[model samples]
Target: MTSDLRLSRFEYGFAQFMSVMASAPAKLEEKPKERTHQTRDRSREPHSRSMPFRNEMGSEMVDIYVGPEEEPFRVHKQKLCRRIPYFDKMFNGQFKEASENVGRLPEDDPAAFDVLME
Candidate 1:
């Protein structure tokens, strides 16, 4: 009688454990439903414009010139001023280069500037 009672209890516990294990996989596999109010139209949004500055000469308004005499890069002042802190200070602050609109970087490599421009 005692053995039968213990066996019944063990069987009941095993059945409950197996039921939970079976349902866990189903719950994990189910995909979450998307919210109805979260519809967004990404295609209608306006794309950004291309860079106005280029490597070519006389293409656009050249605000500042950089690098050595042999290999100089013509870059936009507004773009540089906005992007680089060093350039912003030099161009905006009361300096000789601010008025001249020409910044010479003899020590700095021109290839680096080319990469930056690109």
Candidate 2:
């Protein structure tokens, strides 16, 4: 007949072939495959943990000083010591003394100074 009629006939046959293929099952689905990994306890040392300090008492001071070149960061140390709970109370007296002795470590007592404006 015409080209449009031939195309419609081919489309009907293609559609029927797809429907039959979808109804058929593959032979691989009936076979059991081997697992590469073994089933182990996923809860131990990973998912669950028990911290000693989390249950018991914690330390008085936590020294976590990390600098650019391993040099002791005086500013961070001063800030960190202020948050030590009991140590913050000594801010007016002992903390002030400690702040005075910060950069004056035996060699630079006169480091705390302003330039002359003459």
Whole-model Cα lDDT of every candidate shown, in order: 0.55, 0.33
Q: Model 2 reaches what TM-score against the true structure?
A: 0.17
Encode model 2's per-residue lDDT on 2-109: one tens digit a residue.
555453433554454334334433422345567799886756564334455333333332222222333232333333333332223332235553445332223211
What tens digits encode model 1's per-residue C-alpha lDDT throughout 17-112? 335434554554457677679766767655532222333222433344434654766777766655555666666668887887777666444545
Off by over 4 Å in 1: 1-70
Candidate 1 lDDT score at position 118: 43
Residue 7 of candidate 2: its Cα lDDT? 39
